[model samples]
Target: MQIRLLDLLSRIKRLQEEREILRRNQALELLKTLKKEYEELVEERKKVSQVFTKSRFFKAVELQDLIRLRDSLLEWEKIAEKKLKDGYEELAKIEEELLERHKERRLFERLKEKEMWKQSEEELKRLYRELDELALLIQGQENKR
Candidate 1:
């Protein structure tokens, strides 16, 4: 029964480790995606700025259009920033969960080790008692002889 429990605990530990690895990979992928999006936003902002600078002789309607474009770009930048923040928050939550699973697995492992040690001690004591009884029996035979 103890051996079975130990085996089960080990399996649980391995599963926890695998889960952590998967979460870490997911976090990395999310970070990569966020970085790509940020880079794209930066590139787009730069293009908008270049256009605004190069078109100095804009008519009234053209100027209004440029203003609207700038406002839209600003709104998109805000949205991107919010998305990045949310992604980081999600990663943090996953890391916390992984840490908790690791702690639980370690606790089970410690309990298994303690149980094994106790069983070993009991077996050792039983063997010592058997050896003592055999020795006494041999001494009695010798005395009789």
Candidate 2:
């Protein structure tokens, strides 16, 4: 029963760790994508602004479009930053718990191994004693013969 419980808990911890890892990877990947998109938007906006500056005339419509794009991208980046921060914190917590669970599981496994060794030793001793008795009985019968 104890071993079963330990095994179950170990499996649970491993699963929890796997889930956290996946979440962290996904969060990081999203952040990377957002960064790439933001960079592309900035480059596109810079090119347009430069073109307008050289012409010495601001096209109000184009300027407004650029502003909207920048605003939306910034908003997305803000949200993604928050999500990444939260995910990192959660992953840290899960990792800490995983470390503790691993220690506990290792201790239990060691104790279980020691107990099994003791039982085997006792069984071997019993077998030896039985063999000794059988040998004595055979000797007696041969002497009578």
Q: Top TM-score: which candidate number?
A: 1
lDDT per model vs. reference? 0.84, 0.69
Per-candidate TM equals: 0.86, 0.55
Kindly report which residue stretches of model 1 are placed more than 4 angstroms away from their true locations once superposed: none
Candidate 1 lands at a TM-score of 0.86
Rate residue 85 of model 2 by lDDT.
69
Off by over 4 Å in 2: 1-56, 124-145
Q: Alpha carbon lDDT of residue 102, candidate 2?
A: 61
**What local lDDT does model 1 show for residue 50?**
91
Cα-based lDDT at residue 99, candidate 2:
70
Q: List the residue pairs that clash in candidate 1.
A: none
